[model samples]
Target: MKFTKPFLVLATMLLISSCNSIPKNQEKVISLKNAYQKDFYIGSALDTNQIKEKDAGVSSLIAKEFNSITAENCMKSMFIHPEKDKFDFKMTDNFVAFGEKHKMFIHGHTLLWHSQLAPWIAQIKDSAAMTNAMTNHISTIVGKYKGRINSWDVVNEALNEDGTLRKTVFLDTYGKEYLTLAFKLAAKADPKTDLYYNDYNLCQPTKRKGAVALVKNLQKNGAKIDGVGEQGHWNLTSPSLDEIEKTILDFSALGLKVSFTELDISVLPNPWDVVGADVNQKSEASEKMNPYPNGLPDAVQIQLAARYEAIFKLFTKHQDKIDRVTLWGVNDGQSWLNDWPIKGRTNYPLLFNREFKPKSAYNSVMSLKETKK
Candidate 1:
C-alpha cells in the first residue's frame, strides 16, 4: 500500500524498534565469561590497586570478563600478618567486599608459603612455639574469611624440583607432617572452604610425582584435601600440551578439583636454565632478553594468541575435572612478569593490553567456545 512521507517514516521507526527489541541471548555473544559460562569460571588475581577500584576501566573489565577473583598479594601470609602479633585485614576486607559486590567466586591465595612468610616465623626456635604460631596464624586468617572465601591455597610451592619437600621452617620443625597439620587446621577453621595445595612446575614429571604423593599422603592421614592448583606460568613454548594435560588428568584422578592458577604466557626471553616459578631466581636484564621492550611484534603477538588458545582448548577438554583457570594479573601492564626475573623489562603476558583492551589472545580463547557451537 502506498503511504504518505510521515506514515512511511513512522513505519520505518517501528521496524527499527522491533529489531532492537530482540532478546539479548539472540545477539552475537563474545564475552569470556559468556563464552565459558558452562565450562568453568574465568578468574583473575587482583592487587590492592584494582581491589580498591583505583581504575574504573580495570574494574569494569574484571566484572565483565571474570566470574572469580584471587588476591594477588593482600591474602598472602606476609601481607595479612606483617607483624608477629598484628593481623591486617583492612585491604583484604576491601578485596573480599569487591568480590562479593560483583558476585564473584573468591579464592584465598595461600595459607602457608616459605617465601612470603613474616620474619618472626623464621625466627621461632622451639618446635612447640613454631607449631603454636602456625596454628594461630592459620586459625586466625582462615577463620576471618571462613564462610566468605570459596577456596584457599592451603600450601604453596611445598615441593622442591627433585620431588622432595622444601626445607621451609614448617618442614624443618614439623617435618612432612607440617602439610597435614596445616590442612587440618584450615579444615577446622572453615569446613566449607575448599582447601588446595597450589604449586608451580607441576607439569614436570618429577614435580607431578611429588604432588601426587603429597595429595595421597594428605588423604592417607584423613586431611581435608579438596583441590590442587597448577600455576600456568608458561610462555609460547615449553611445557608441551601433553605435559599440561597429563598433570590435569593425574591430579583429577585423585578425585580433587584442579585449577590452572596464576595463568600467564610471558613473551620474553629467559636464561637457558631458568625453569619453574621460583621468586628467588633472577637473571640480569639485557637487550637480548627484553627484545620486545617497545612492543610485541606482530609475529610474536600471533604466537601469544595461539599459546592462549591452546591452553583454553585444553581447559575446555577437561572441564569436568577443572574448577577454575585464573590469570595471574588483569592486564599486561600490571603483570608481575615485567619485574619478576629481571626488573625494568617490558613483557606482554596477559589477555588484555596496558589499556585494558582485550588482545587477540582474548579473542582466541572466546572463539574456542563459539567454535564448539
Candidate 2:
C-alpha cells in the first residue's frame, strides 16, 4: 500500500519522536548484592518487622539487594537470652530462617556486649559465676546455629575511646580474660564459623592501637579470631577517607579480614564535637538540631551521594582485604539514627529513602565501578 505524501511525512515524524523518547544509554541498573558479588558480600541489618516479613516492600528490597543479613536487635544478649535461665529464640529463629530462605549469609551480632547485658548477668559479682554465665551464653547460642550462622561479633565495643579496655561487668569480674574467654567459647562452639571483635571509633589512632593490642592479646591466649569489624556509624564528614583506609589496612595487616559492619552515614549535625555510637548519650531536641524535618534538600542529597561514592571507591580499591559491608538498616525511616544523639529528629542516613526507594547515595555507590570502567 503506497502512502500519500502527507501520510508518509506524518509517519516519519512519529517515528523520530518515538526514537527520541528512548534513552541513548540503556544500561541496566544493578542490584547492590550483584554489584559487589565478586568483591565481597553486601548485607543489611534486619529488625523484627523485617524478619517477620511484615512489610512486603521492605522484604522484597532486602531479598533483591542484600546477600547477607544481621539481626539488628533480636540476636543481642538482651533479647535472645532475656532471663538468666530462659533462652528465647522466637525472633532469632525467624531471623535465621529468613536469611536461609534467601540463601544469604547470616551474621550473629554481639555474643557479648556491655550495653545490652542482661540484668542477672550484670549483677553477678563472683568471677566463677561470671565465667559460667559467659560460657553458657556463648556455647548455647553459638552451638545452636553452629553451621548455619556464617560469622559472629564475639565482642562488641569493649574498648573506650582512649583505647583502654572499658571497665564493664565482664572486665571487672572476669578481667581481661573475658575477651579471650568469649572468643574461645565461640570458637569451641562452632569451629567453622568466623569470629570477630567489633567496635566503634576504630578509625581513631588511639582506639585503633587498642584494637590491635586486643587482637594480639587474644592471639597470645590462643583465641581463634577471624576478622575485626569497625562499626561504620559515621556522619556526613569526619572520619576522613584516609583514616578509614588506614584502619582497613592496619586490621588487614594483622592477617584478619575487615568488615564495615553497621555501616550508615548520618547527614545531620552532631550535638557533640566527637560522634560516637554510645546508646546512653542523648541530646535534647530543638528546631536547629532537626534541620530536615520534611526531607533532605537537593544540595544535601548531592553531598551525601559524593560522600558515599568516595567511601565505596576506597572499598572497591581494597576489595580483596574486605569480607563484607553491611548497612545498619534497610531504609532511612527505620534507621536508629532518627532517635540517636537527639531524639525525634529526622535523619537521612542509608542509601534507601523512607519509601524503600534508592536515593542519590544508592545510585552513586552502584555506579562507582561503572564510572571507573
Which candidate should be chosen as best, given TM-score against the real structure? Answer: 1
Q: Give lDDT: candidate 1, residue 303.
A: 97
TM-score of each: 0.95, 0.92
Steric overlap count per candidate: 0, 0
Residue-wise lDDT of candidate 2 within 1-373, one digit each (tens)?
A: 8889999999999999987785635545579998788889999999899999998878988999999999999988888898999999999999999999999999999899998778888898989999999989999999999899999999999999989999899998989889999999999999999999999889999999999999999999999999999999998887999999999999999999999999999999888654579988888889989999999999999999999999999999999999999999999999999999888899999999998999999999989755544
What TM value does model 2 have? Answer: 0.92
lDDT (CA) per prediction? 0.91, 0.93
Model 2 poorest ten-residue lDDT run: 21-30
lDDT of 1 at 138: 94
RMSD (Å) per prediction: 2.4, 5.0
Best-performing candidate as measured by lDDT = 2
lDDT of 1 by residue, 1-373 (tens): 7789999999999999998997664655567878888889899999889999988977888999999999999878788898789999999999999999999999998889999788888777767987898899999999988899999999999999988999899887778889999999999999999999999999999999999999999999999999999999998897999999999999999999999999999898888877888998898878998898778899998999999899889889999999999999999999989987888899999999998888999889877876655
